[model samples]
Target: MAAAIKLASDRGVSAIELVFARNLFSLPVVATWLTLAPGWRAVRTRRPLAHLSRAGLGLGSMTLNFIALAMLPLADATTIGFSAPLFATILSALVLREKVGRHRWLAVAIGLAGVAVAMRPGGASLPAAGLAIALAGALGTGAVNITLRQIGRTEGVAATVFWFTVISLAVSGLGLPFFAGSHDWQLWALLVLIGVSGGCVQICNTASLRLAPVAVVVPFDYLQLLWAMLFGWVLWATVPGPATLAGGGLIVASGLYTVWRERQLHRSHLPATPTEL
Candidate 1:
């Protein structure tokens, strides 16, 4: 994803234009997969409004995150974006009425502190606009997570992915009139690669949620920070500063602890199986 965004930036495409390219190219492939695998009926849902809301938030999240990426260092953008899980925890408490223990609450605070550290207040290194947009994108992502949990109870992964893609395409297409411009063949190829890889990533993400509880799977997502750093260094010669390393470390640790605590709580509530005489 970092590479794709860099390619878009190099190609002189606006964030919205890249999003438009991604959805426009991805729609047909997603539609074809839906048709062949589960038939077109797989896209049907009893909750069109829910899907629409989720998609709208998702599109907003993607646009903001991409814009942040374009304007900020990859490591900074990726590290700050890690706050999404923290936002999700808070949203789950508010929206789903889920009980959050004191430990998790403390962890959330620590995670947020990490974000503050990374922001490096009064520092010249941070891009204020990019950081703010990245945080907003993370909040949008958290909201999307809540909606996905709600709709995932009855919606198949195929349907969820397909509907979101359709909605994203429609919304992004609306920006075409204002942002549309020509790209050379190489750029076109890169855009197609971006779209395809993005679809694959979405599929994997949806599949992980389906196979395991979010608490069990989400901690692994922090791996993105490493990938971001690598891509930043290799492609743009951007190095991670002390603030990024320190703050990102705290955030990742706090998030992992929260996931572990959730798993322990879940285990304690399960009915114990016994084989002893």
Candidate 2:
């Protein structure tokens, strides 16, 4: 997705247009699923406002992240986006009234510190807009998480996904007239790939969570940075600089700690075994 966005931007595609294309591509997939599986009833929702809010957040996050992708190196943009977990933790506490233990709070602080380390403030190479957009996108991601938590209580997963894609497509498509850019066959193909890949990734991610314990599969998500780095080097010959490397390391560590703490908390809540007694 990052590669496609960057390439599209390079080829003069507007951020709005790029996201519009992606959502447009994704819409049919969801529609096809609805047609073949659960049908229209699957999209029925009692929480229209909540779904709308989540879709808004999703749009903001995707758009800002795409813009950041255009401005920053692929790895840096991708790593910064990982801060979403940190932001989501805070949102969970504030919005969901979920208790955040001291350990988790400390992990949040450490995770933010990792972001700061990655930014390398006072350095000549800082791209302020890119970083800010990425950070804001992460925060938007947190909002999306909070909204999803509420929506998930009453809404089916298919409903949430369908509404999100619809809202994203409508909002972005509205701006397409002013922002859309010219694309030859190759660029057009990239845009299509962007949508298809985005949908596939989302499906795979959802499937992973459903099929296994989240704690078991989530850690593998951090491997995205490794993939981003590899993609960066291979596609653009862009090696992660020191700040990116250091920052990415801290972000990954902090995220892992957060996950570990969640798993520990989950374990603590389980029925005590007779052996322990």
- In order, candidate lDDTs are 0.83, 0.79
Q: Judged by lDDT against the true structure, how good is candidate 2?
A: 0.79
What C-alpha lDDT, on a 0 to 100 scale, does residue 141 get in candidate 1? 78
lDDT score for residue 76 of model 2: 87
Best by lDDT: 1
**Tens digits of per-residue lDDT for model 1 on 193-264?**
778877877767776776765444655778899999998898889899999999999999987898888788
Report the lDDT tens digits of candidate 2 across residue range 108-171: 7877887888777887475899889989988886677666667766777778888888888888
How high a TM-score does candidate 2 get? 0.90
| Candidate 1 structure lDDT | 0.83
